[model samples]
Target: MAPSELRPVRRRLDAHEPEPEDAEDIEEYPDDGFDGRVRLDPGRRGMVALVGVGVAAVVLAGWFVWRDHPVSQPVPALPVVVTTSEAAEPAVAADLVVSVVGAIARPGLVTVPPGSRIADVLLAGGGALPGTDLLGLNLAQKVSDGDQIVVGAPAPPMSSAGASNAGTSGGGGSGGGDADDSTGKTLSLNDATESDLDALPGVGPVTASSIVAWRDANGPFTSVDQLGEVDGIGPARLEKLRDLVAP
Candidate 1:
């Protein structure tokens, strides 16, 4: 065979070539039987579940404590009620019994309250008779309980000669008219007649006669205090007699 006509002969390999590995096939390796991965067994899984349940129970307990234990609030106190009553009034005293005498139309015991005046007693005795002497008498004077009020008769009109004679004898002396006029001589218990004595407070005809008899039996009184020694003369009576008499 000519060299030009000879064909290229094929070469034969002694060993077989390895197949190429793809990137996806290399990453998809199966799990090794002896790897360090953690595994939860039945007991370990139960422990984890119990821890979760314990945490839930703690949260529920805390919520219950918060709901039950609220902030403290102060309670308001109630007001008290008070009731008041009115006071009672005091009672008034009773009236007193007194007698009026002198020149009054009617003279007798009269009912009067305490602190009554002489004018009140005189009014009770039907007022003074016409032309009775009211000089020197303090009609505004207050009278005590059981007091005696007396009115006096008017003096007779005097002539000049008679007045001169009277002035010379008993009219001008210390125990005479001038003295009597100055010291309430219109009501004289010593020299007065029964009618005049009867004209005194609390003195009737009988009491006037008794006073005259007593005066006749006794001596002239030295002081007005001696009037209390007479019968029916008490503190109340003495108080009335004090104004009408002189020592």
Candidate 2:
């Protein structure tokens, strides 16, 4: 055969030859600027965007719920107010009125305690005048209501010659000793004056007056023990005066 005819025959034979056994399979790809990237469909892209939006909306809703329901704080308690009631005070006891007359700066009626003694009345009367015979009166004795005290001049001291005469002439002696009969023997309760009765133990001026008043009302006491019949003079008091008084 000719060379030209051989070239056309070789071309036909090469075209009919089989491919290599070790050749790699190539996948078809489209060119859109990004290489080695997979392209998604429009519907698939829309599904992914919807899922992202739904997750974001869920996170936003959780944040709003947490904001609306915040943790609570404890409240403080209020202070209490106290109220008090006003009341009036009670009345007190009144003072006792007594008439005080003697040798003093201001001798008249004076208010004193219920159990004022003679010394207290003397002080309330601006004290005794100079040279007033204080020993003649019972300074330790308690005074009563409307009592009149006379402050007399002291008796002149008896001379030793006159003291012997006083012993010889008994009736000629002064009668001032009669007021102090308690210094001697038993006193007669039926004849005793209120001042003499005041010398008895536990027998104040008030009780002495009550005794004289009882004797006047009920006659003379029959027995010395009958002194217990008087008010404020109980068995204990009568027992004290048993050796000191006579019916």
Candidate 3:
């Protein structure tokens, strides 16, 4: 074998020298003098770790407290007030004054409620005498104030003085007064019926009813002249009736 092809002989190492290695076997390494990051000592590192652990524990405790209960704003209260009021009173209707007479239990002046009827007047007069016929009376007719209600019997006859005020001829009206008892022909203004007044010259049924209504409203006539107060009885009409009637 050629000398060049022979294996390189390895030298034995001495105690004072370093061992030699082949160039191909030696490895290239990067420079490693020191790192850019700051390093701490064992004691300092331990203190930093302890401080971090303490900070984390404190943060965790704060999170737990905040999750359980939160802060809230307070609200203000308002005041209440009370009030009182008075009630009003009701109104009452006025009563009417009327005269109830004739065959009733009690015949006299009586006060009744307004818009009362003839039946009410009968009740006010202690009602008509027992068995008294009511078929002749208009119990449903409305009565006014100062009205005279006669029940169960005829009206009383008029006296001479009252007849004189009538200015009427007797049962046989001759348009003038007659002094003789047999044919004196005296007509009582108070007792005279509507037919009697209608018989007077120039007096009609309308005028006669007006007279009766006026009498019913004003009571028995004090004088024949008072008839002038009736409605539709103007000064001219009154003059015509004045001679036809006395009073």
Q: Say which candidate scores most in TM-score.
A: 1
Give all TM-scores, in the order shown: 0.38, 0.32, 0.32
> Using alpha carbons, what is the TM-score of model 1?
0.38
lDDT of 3 by residue, 157-227 (tens): 34445456454544465434342332324345677788776555434456668888988888998886787
Runs in model 2 with CA error above 4 Å? 1-91, 99-109, 113-117, 135-183, 193-212, 222-247
> By TM-score, how accurate is candidate 3?
0.32
Name the best candidate (by lDDT).
Answer: 1
Per-residue lDDT of model 2, residues 16-100, tens digit only:
9987655456555667876867766659889999899999999999999999997999988888876657666777645544444
Estimate every model's Cα lDDT from 0 to 1. Answer: 0.67, 0.66, 0.65
- Show pairs that collide, candidate 2: none
Ranking by lDDT: 1, 2, 3
